[model samples]
Target: MVETDKPKQHRSRVLEGMAHAVSQKGYGDTTIADIVREASVSRRTFYEHFSSKAECLVALYEAASHNSLKVLRDAIDPAHEWQTQVERALAAYLGSMQANPVLVRTLFIEILHLGPEGLAARRRVNSVVADFILSMVNGSKGPKSHVLSSGMATAIVGGINELVLEYIEQDKVKYLDELVQPASDLVHAITRT
Candidate 1:
């Protein structure tokens, strides 16, 4: 049992190191050597953790989602208007991305090439955001209270994700406040209690 657990722990460490390296060097440029070096582990150790770079990326996506979800949860306020809630969530996400631009680029753009795992991670984040929005519209009762389609919720979150990416990549926020109103409006317009 101990030996089995060791591999799992090492895998997490390797994934974390890869995320850090990719954040700095980008996924395309990052190599296995860089990941193992970042983890301070030997080549054999890395192989024990993952079969290849793609597997490492799968783990990285999970890590990034966990971090992003924490930030989003903190931004939520039960007392705030649904509009304000959306704004706060967007602000929180964008702020996090701005603070960790390299990580954002790796998770959002680079790691996508890793196939199913990467795509699933992205979808998981989107679902989280949709659920958050649904909560605001439905209150504690959940989807039963809000009549919005799942498709609409997905679209709104996707748009928000794209917008956040643009804001991060361009290194400019010409009118940051505008993002809030539109984001809130989009959610409010679609959601009916």
Candidate 2:
């Protein structure tokens, strides 16, 4: 029987190496050889782990998003007010993005240059974020606005995503807290009946 655990472990190492390589070279420019070389594995090993560079990028994106979601959830206390929770979540996401700027850059910008597979992966990430925001707003303290809910949630998520992209582009995360209120306000405005 094939050793499943060995393949899983090798795939993980390849993913880490791809993240490192892309963080330096970017997604559009990175090649299979670049990944395998940085990973210190042979071409066959790279193929064994991933079918293409796009797959590696998608895996990298999934890993980063998963980690950021955990950080965001941990940043808020369950007992806090809805707005406070929003602020905490935003702060956590921005903070994590700032800390791992390379990951954010590669996942957002570089992934865009790839084929349909990468785009689909990005859409999946966006859908996950959208769903999370929807759940949070729907569960907020006060009454919910069914009519504006979807647009409001999309706006909130899009705004935060753009702000994070800007932070990564500028190489600075100054005034992350300042962004929270405006983001919250935008959400409120959009959702208010």
Candidate 3:
């Protein structure tokens, strides 16, 4: 393998290892040793990517969240009806989360164990999601006077996250798709006002 690609590959493996260990043993019980073992990389290599388990988990949280957001982003079609776009995007986002039950639990539930650091990582991702919602709502084919403010967008993201957290907590991650319609309704309801 190329030298540059090797580091990235190791980092990715470590991240996956963290996710795997967290999913199996929960973040509280998982150790750096477990991560390296699952990742098939050396402890030195793990440190090269992450300083501690919390950092590794946070990175995994961010990576998984970004991937889900990408699904939401790609599902949007500006040319379609605004309501349709919202529904599709919501469905796609939930579908992406449902696709990986392990991440659904580890990223949504376990990350919070990191306290402030976890919250900050979650806030950063939520802000990006809010921005995406802003673009979709403001750029939609709706009333000229109707504008979805950043605060409301943030609130919507939080609400959706709460719904996801509930599902993960209940071990119903596979049923996350059930939230799409209600979540989409919320965006429509708020944006219309």
Candidate 4:
């Protein structure tokens, strides 16, 4: 069992280290040595988990996205009205992001400097978020074809992301929850049609 668990533990440490390194030095200046030092692990251990800085950043992004998605999934209550559900989910998402400002900055801002690999990871994360929005929209009652299509869901995700990015850029990540109402309004406007 110890043998089986070691890899998972090492991976977690590496991810934590990546978040710290990127948050401190930004992705452009972070190196494998920095990650290992931040993680308190050997260089070999870092390489055991990730091939490169970009790869490590991707892993960190994926892990963080997975965790945030869980918070969102748990926040959703099917019994509530659709608009209420959207508000709850949005609040939960923004709250999670606010609670982890460093991770959010690293994931959203620093990761972008990783070039194509970063772009690909970002696209994948956006697609996953869009899928969640699509599920929520599909579960709610709305006009058959007036709005709330997969494309619309993707667009909504983009808008929400932009809003969060604005907050991050302005160093107002704590105000992210303030966006819940506007975000919900945007989603509700389309779905209510």
Tell me the spans in candidate 1 whose CA falls farther than 4 Å from its real position: 1-12, 79-81, 140-146, 171-182
lDDT of 4 by residue, 76-184 (tens): 8777655656788889988999999879997688878888888899989889988887777676654444546788888888888888899899999988899999888
Kindly provide the TM-score of model 3 when superposed on the true structure, using C-alpha atoms: 0.94
lDDT (tens digit, per residue) of candidate 1 on 51-116? 888877877776776787788778877656554466678777666766665566676687687668
Which of candidates 1 and 2 is the stronger one according to lDDT?
Answer: 2
Worst 10 residues of 4 by lDDT: 139-148
Best by lDDT: 3
- Sorted by lDDT (best first), the order is 3, 4, 2, 1
- Which segments of model 3 are wrong by more than 4 Å? 141-145
TM-score of each: 0.75, 0.82, 0.94, 0.92
Encode model 3's per-residue lDDT on 1-193: one tens digit a residue. 8898999999999999988898899999999999999999999999988888998998899999889888987887766766657777888889988988878887777988999999899889889999988887787675645777899999998888888888887878889999988897787777774
lDDT of each: 0.72, 0.73, 0.86, 0.84
User: What is the C-alpha lDDT profile of model 2 across 1-193, one tens digit per residue?
Assistant: 3687878777877887888888888776788888888877888998876788887788888888888878877876667655556666776776677677657677667777776877787778777877777766677665566644665566667777787667667765554555666766676676662
Predict model 1's lDDT versus the native: 0.72
> Comparing 2 and 3 by TM-score, which wins?
3
Q: Which order, best to worst by TM-score?
A: 3, 4, 2, 1
Which runs of model 2 end up more than 4 angstroms from their true locations? 1-6, 141-148, 173-178
After TM-score superposition, what is the CA distance of residue 98 in candidate 2 from its true location, in Å? 1.0
lDDT of 4: 0.84
Find the number of clashing residue pairs for candidate 1.
Answer: 0
Give the top-scoring candidate (TM-score).
3
How far residue 36's Cα lies from its native spot in candidate 4, in Å, is: 0.9
